[model samples]
Target: MAKIEQVLESIGAMRQGRTGRFSRGVRRGLYGIFDLTAMTAVLALVVLIYIRFYGEWVIDHRADALQAASSAVIEDRTGTAVWRASLPEGGYREVASAAEIPLLVKQAFIGTEDRRYALHEGIDYTGIVRAAAVNVRSGGTAEGGSSITQQLARNVYLTLDQTWMRKLNEASIALALERHYVKDEILTMYLNEIYMGRGQYGIKAASRRYFGTAELNRLELWQIAILAGIPKAPSAYNPVDDPERAAGRAKVVLGLMAEQGVITAAEADAAAVRAAAYEAPQQSVVDAAGTAAYAAAALREAARKTGLPEEQLRGGGYRIETGLDAAAQAALTGVFAEDAYFPPDMGGQQTEAAMVVVDHRDGEVRALAGGRNGDGAGLNRAVDMKRQPGSAFKPIIAYGPALESGRFSPDSVLPDVLQTYGGYSPRNVGGVYRGSLTMTEALTRSINSPAVWLLNQTGISQAIEFAARLGIELGSEDEHLAIALGGLHEGVSPLQLAQAYSVIANGGTFRSAHFVRSVTDAQGQEIYRFDPEAESRPAMSAWTSAALAFMLRNAVAEGTGQAARIPNRIVGGKTGTVALAMKEVSQAANRDVWFAGFTPEWTAAVWMGFDRTDSGHYLTVPGSAAAGLFSAAMGKMLAGR
Candidate 1:
C-alpha cells in the first residue's frame, strides 16, 4: 500500500513538471510572433513615409521638372541682337534632338557613363550596392553610382551636395523625370544639358569645341569615345588642355564599350589607337567686337535687376534690351583700334586704354571700349578696373563741394602756395605754384595746393558726403586732405567717373549708370524696364552745377584739358594724372592718366595706363593724351547730333 501511494505521488510530480514546460513554450512562441509583427509594422511605416515624401516633393512638380536650356539674346537700343550670351561656362549650347544623336554616340555614352542604363528604372540598385561596398572599403566616396537620369536631376534642380538629403532629393527627382519623359527624351535632355570642358555645354557644343565640328553623325568613333569620357570629369579630361590624359580616359571608355558588346574588341582597340594619335585643333582667338563688352555689361545688369544668377540669365532665353548706341559703339571701337589715336608705347609695353560713355539724359550707358585691338571679351576695364583719378577728383570732391557749400564761388580766390596738412604736403604739376588764383584758374591749372586747401576749408566729411551724392562712394581711409587730389584708398573706375560727371551734364541730378534698358522672357513678357525717376536723385543745386560747368568748360578751352574740346558742343572736363613712384618721378612718368568730361548730351571718361605701373611700364605722356582720346571718341559719338 505504501509503495503504491509513493508511485502515485511521483506520477503527479512528473505531470506538474510537463505542464510547466508546455506553458513556458507557449509564452516563448507568443513573444516571437509579437516581435515579428512589430518589425513588419515598422518597415511598412518607413515605406509609407518614403512614398509620401516622394509623391509630395517630386511627382507634383513633374511638368516643370527639367529646366529648359536656351541661349539668351542681347539686343541694342535699335532692337537688333548685338550678342548672344552663351550658357554657363562660356560656350553656346546647341541642344540636339533625339533624331540628331547618332547611335554610336549614344552607345558610347551609355557604356561609359551608365552601364545597364536601359535596364534601370531611374536608379541602379546594383551600382549603388557596389559603390557602397567600394566606398566602405576606401573610406571615402571613390565612386558615384548616379545614373544618367540622376545626373540630369542634380544638374538641373538639385545642387551637387554630398549630404544624404540631397541624395534623396536627387533620387526622387530622377524618378519623377523618368516617369514624366520617355527614355529617348530623357537621353536627349541629358546629352543636351551636361557641362563639357572648355566652357562648353551639350554634345553639339562639346563636339565643336573638341573636334571642330558640331554634326554628331560626322564624329569618328574615337572622338565619340573621347566625348563620352569627358562628362566624368570635365577639367581633368579636357582634350584641348591635356590630350594624354584625355586619350587614356577615352581608352577606358573604349574598353567599357568593348566589354558591354557595343563594339567588337578589335574595333574598340582601333578606336583607342586613333584616340591616342588624335591632336586637338588649335583654337582661334575670337576678336570680339566692342559690342560684346556692352552685351556683357547688359547681361550683368539683367541678372542684378531680375535677381537671377548669371548662369540662369545666360541660358533662360531672355531678350535683354540695352541702352547701346550702335553708332557710339562703332566710333569708340574705331578709335580704340587705331594705334595712331593712342600714345606711343613706352619701354616696349603697349599702353592699354578703357572708355565709358553715358547719356546724361537718362543715365544710359551708350558705349564702352574695354581694351585695344577689339579684345572686348578680356578683362573689362571700363567698369571693372579701378585706377587713381588724380586731379579728376577736384571737381567732384573739392571745387564742386566748395561751390555747393556757398562759402566759395567759381570766382572765389584761394591760395595756391605749396602747403602741408597733417604731415602731408601737396604741390601742383611740375611743382610750380602761383601765389594766389581764382577757383576757376586753380581748377583750370589743376593746381594741387588750392584743391587740398579748399577741401580742408569745406571739411573732408562734407566733401565726402557730396561725392557720395554723385555716386562716388568714398571709404573711411579717404578722410584726409590728399583726397582733394583724387588720392583714395581704392580709386574709381571709368564708369564711376562718367556717372559722377553726369551730375553736371544732367543739371545737378544724379542717375545711376545702367546698361540694360529692359528684359523680356522667351514668351515675350516684359520682365524688367528701367525707371529713370526711381534712379534719379538731387546731387547738387542747379546753380552749383552751372557754376562748375562754366569753370570746367574754361578748363577744356584754355587749361590742361584743351585737347578734350569738341567743336560746336559745349564741352567741359577735367584732366588728371598720377605720377609714377618717387624713383621715376624725374622722368615725368605718369602711372595713370584720365580725362572725364561731358557734353550737353553725353558724359564720357577715358583712362589709359599699364595694368601694372612699374618703372618699366609707365605712361610717358600727360593727361592730355587721354583727353585727346576722349575728343576723338566723343566727336564720332556726337556726329549725328
Candidate 2:
C-alpha cells in the first residue's frame, strides 16, 4: 500500500511538471504576439505623426511634384499656351511612357536599386533591416535601402536631409503615393523623375543630353546600363567626367540584371565588354527659352489675382488663360522695342517704355509690354515703376470734378493767365498761356494755369476724392494744388493710368485692372476666374464722363494730343510730359512722357522714360512721341480685330 502511494505521488508530480511546461509555452507564444502587436502599434503611431505634420508638405507640393513631366503654361486670349516656364528644374523635361523605356533599362534599375520592388508596398522591411545591419557594422551611413518610390518621394516632396525624421517622412509620403497611384504609374514617374547630371532632370532628358537623341529604345544594352546607373549618384558616376567609374557602375548594373534573371550571364558579359570600350562625348550648352513680355505680365497678374505665389504658379502645372490678345501684344512690343522710338535728337539716351491696353467694355487688359529687350519679367515698368503723369491727371482732377460738381461746363470760360495757389505758381508749356479760354479749350491744350484755377474752384479735397473714386491712389503729400497739374508724391503706373482712363471710357464705372481671364489646372479644371462684368462700382456720373470724353476728343482732334489721332475711329486722349530739373548736362535733364487715351473699343496708356533717375538727356520734342506710339499700336490692334 505504501509503494502504491509513492507511485501515485510520482505520477502526480509528473503531471504537475507537464502542466507547468504547457503554461510556460502559452506565455511565451502570448509574449511573442504582444511584441509583434507593440511593434505594429509603434509603426502606426509613427505613421500617424508623420501624417499629422510632415504629410501636408507633400500634399502642398504634389502638383509641382507631379509636374516633373511638364511646365506651367501661360495662355493667350485664344486659350492657347503662349509662354512656358519650368520654374523648379529651370528647363523642359519629357515624361516617358513605359514602352519608351527599354525593358533592359527597367530591369537594370530595379535589380540594382530595389530588388523587391514588385513585392513591397513602397517601403521594404527586409531591405531596411539589411541596411540597418550594414550601417551598424560600419558605424555610419554605409547603405541606403530606399525603394524607387521612396526615392521619388524624397526627390519630389522632401529635401535630402540625413535625419531619422526625414526618413520617416519619406516612408509616410511613399505610402501616400502608393495609395494614390498604381504600381506602373509610380514606377514610370520615378524613372522619369530622378535627376541625372547636366541640366537634365529626368531619365528621358538625361538620355537625350548624353546620347544627343531622344530615341531611348534604340540605345545599346551598355548605354542603357550607363544611363540607368546614373540616378544613384549622378555627379560621381557622370560618364563625361569619369568614364571608367561610369563603366564600373554599368557593370554592377549588368551583374545585378543577370542575378535577377533579367539577362543571361553571356549577355551581361557582352555589355561589360562594350562598356569598357565606350567613350562619353562632350555636352553642348543649351540656351534657356525666352518668355514674352505680355505673357510674363499675365503670369504675375495671375499670381496676384489668384493669391497664388509665383513659385507655386510656376510649378503648379497651371494653365493660365490670360486676357492678352497675342497679336495686339506682339504689335505693341514691336513698336516700343524699336530704336527709332528713341530718336538721337530726343536725348540720345537709352529709353525704356511701358504700355497697357484695356478693353473699355470689360476692363480686361488686352495687351501689355515693359522693357524693349528684356526677358519681360525683370523690371516690369508697366505695372511696377510709378512716374509722374504730368498733365494726364489734369482731366481727372480738374475737368472731371468740375463737370461732376455742376460748377463748370465744356463752354464755361476760364482765365488761362499765370496763376498762383499758396506759393505754388503753375504755368502752361513754355509759360505761354491763352489769356482766356473755355474749359474745353484749356483741357484740349493742357493749359496748366486754368487747370489750377479749376482745382481751386472744385476744392483740392473734392478733386482728389473724385480721382480716388476712379481708382487713382493718392497720398498725404498729394494735397498740394500741384496734383491738379499731375505732380504727385508718388506717380502712377501705366496699368493704373489705363484703368483710371478706362473709367471715363466705360461711362463712369470703376473696374480694377486684371490680366488673367481664367486659370485652370493641368487637368483642365477651372481653379479661378474673373468675370469682367463683375465690376460695378460707380466713379462719376455718366454725364460728367461724357462731357470729359467730348473735350478729350477735341484734344486728340486739334490740340496737344493731336498726334494720337486715328482716322477710322474717334479718338480721345490727354498728353503729359514732365521734365526732371537736374544740374548736369550729360546727366541733368530727362523727361517722363505719357499719353492716356481711348477709343470706344479700348482705353490705353503709354509711358516713355529712362529706367534710371539721373539721366542727363531730356526730351526736346512734345508729347507727340508717346501719342504717335499710342496711335500706331491702336491702329494695328483695331485692324487685327
Candidate 3:
C-alpha cells in the first residue's frame, strides 16, 4: 500500500511541472530513500519481466531467421543492389553494398525517430519514468522512449505486432544484442541496419542517390550531415521531394555537426548557400565531332569500332572517333540551312538530305548525313536507307564497261535515237536525240539513248555483273532495258552505292565499308576488330576507270552539274532523279534528286528528297537540286581541316 502511495505522490508532483532541482514529493529522510529503492526495484522487475516474456520465446527464433534471410540475399545481386537503369539524367548510378541500400549516397543512419537514443542501454528507463510521471500528472500515458539498440532490435527481428507479445519479443532481442555486443558496437550495428529513403535500406545508398556522388572517406561535412538528417523519414526531407524541408532538416544536422566540431560554422554557412542555389548539369561536351554535324551519321556508323552495345553507342558515354571533319559537318549544316538549296516556298522540306564520304581504298566510310537537319533523326540514312541511285548508277553499267571494252572507248560512235530492245524504249529528257555522238560525248551529256545503246551492246547480264562488281546489287539482269537510263531493279542503300562509285575512283579496289573500329566488353576485353578489305578487282582496269573519270569531269565543267563545279579541283560524279512516282504533285515533277561523286581522295554521295514518298514534297525537277547539295557538302567537307 505504501509503494502504491509513493508512485502516486511522484506522479502528482510531476503533474504540477518540474525540470530543475527537486521540487517534487518532499518528505523526511528514511521513508524517502526507502521509497526510492522501492521504485528502483520495481523498474528492475519490469525490465526482468519484459526480458523474460520476450527473451526466449520470440527473440531467439527471429534472430536465427533474420540471419538466414541475410544469407539467402547474400548472393542475389538485385536484392543487394539499388540502381538498375541508365537514365537520361546526368550522373552515375549507384547500388547498395552488403546492406540493401545505395552505398555512396547514404552513410551510417541514426535511429533518429527515437527521441532517447543515446542515454539508455537498450530501452530508456529514465525517459520511461519521466514520461510516465508526466503522463500521470496530466491524466493519461503521454510519451514513450526507445534507445538505438531497441529500435534496431524491433526493425531487424520483430514485425510491428502491436500486441504485448511483440513488445516483449523486441525487449528480449534488445537484451540479447546488448549482451553480445559492446554499447558502441551495438550503436554501430543499429546505425548500419536502419532504412533510408529511395528504396535504400541503408544510409550510404540514400546519400549517393540524392547528392550526385559520395565517397565515405571523402564525404564533405554537409554530405555526412545530410546523410545523418535522412534517417528520419527520408521522403519528408528528400531534396527532390521537398527541398525546403530537406534543407531545414539538413541545417539541423549541420548544427549538431558544428556543435560536435565535425565542421565549422563557416562551413555550414557555405553548404547552406550551395544547397540553396543548385544548377543542373549538362552531359559532358566532347570536342571530337566538333564541326561536322554532317559527319554525325558517319560517326554513328563508326560506333561499330567500339563494339559498344547499340543502345549505349547511341546514348551512352561514348566518345566516337569518327572520320567526320567537324568543319565539314558544320559547313554542311550551315549551307543547307541557307537559301540556296531548299525550295523557296516555305523553304525546302525536301531540303533535308543525306550525304556520305567514302574512302576508295578498302571503302572506309568517312562521312554521312541522315538529313539536311543533321543529328535531328540521329540516324544515317545513307547506310540505313535504300534509295535509287538514279542516273548516278549509269557510269558503272553502261559508261565504264563500254569504255573498257577497247571496242568502244570514249571516242567510239554510238547512235542517240530512241531504240526499242526487249520492249523497253529509252528516251532523252525531252525525247530529242542528238542524232549520233561519240561515247565520251554521250556520257558527258548523260544522254539516255546512247547509254541504252551501250547497255545493249554489252548485254544486260554483263551490265548487272558490272554493277555488282562495283557493289550495286541488282535484283535481276533479265528485267527491263530502261535501266540503261539508270533505272535500277531493287535499288541500293546510299552507303553501298557510295562504295560502288568509290571503287571506280580508287582504281578498282573495293573496300568494304565499316563503322566500328574496335570493341571492348564491359570487362574491358577486346572482342572484335574490323578487317579493311585490301584486294582490288578487275571491274575496270585503271585505264578504263581513268577514262570514265575524265568523261564525267565535264559534268561539273559545263554539263548538268555545272552548279556543282568547284574552281580548279577535278571532280567526277552523276546526278539522279527518283522521278515523282507519287500522286498529288509534291512540287512539280521532280521526285528525288541525288549526286554521287568522287575526288581522288574522297568519294561523297548526297541525296535530296521529301521525308515521305509523296510527290507533293519531293523535287519537281530532275537532277539539278541534288547537284547543288552535293557541291555544298563537298565544299564544306574539303574546306579546312
Residue pairs clashing in model 1 are none
Relative to the unseen true structure, what is the C-alpha lDDT of residue 204 in candidate 1, on a scale of 0 to 100? 81
TM-score of each: 0.63, 0.66, 0.58
Greater-TM-score candidate between 1 and 2: 2
Q: Sorted by lDDT, highest first, which candidate order results?
A: 1, 2, 3
Model 3 lDDT, residue 141, Cα: 59
Candidate 2 Cα errors over 4 Å, as ranges = 1-70, 92-182, 191-291, 345-349, 522-525, 531-534, 583-589, 615-617
CA RMSD, predictions in order: 10.4, 10.9, 14.2
lDDT of 1 by residue, 464-491 (tens): 9999999999999988888888888999
| Candidate 2: residue 355 lDDT (0-100) | 85
Q: What is the C-alpha lDDT of each candidate?
A: 0.86, 0.80, 0.61
Q: Is candidate 1 or candidate 2 better by lDDT?
A: 1
Clashes of 3: 35
Report the C-alpha displacement of residue 314, candidate 3, in angstroms.
Answer: 6.5
**Highest TM-score against the true fold, candidate:** 2
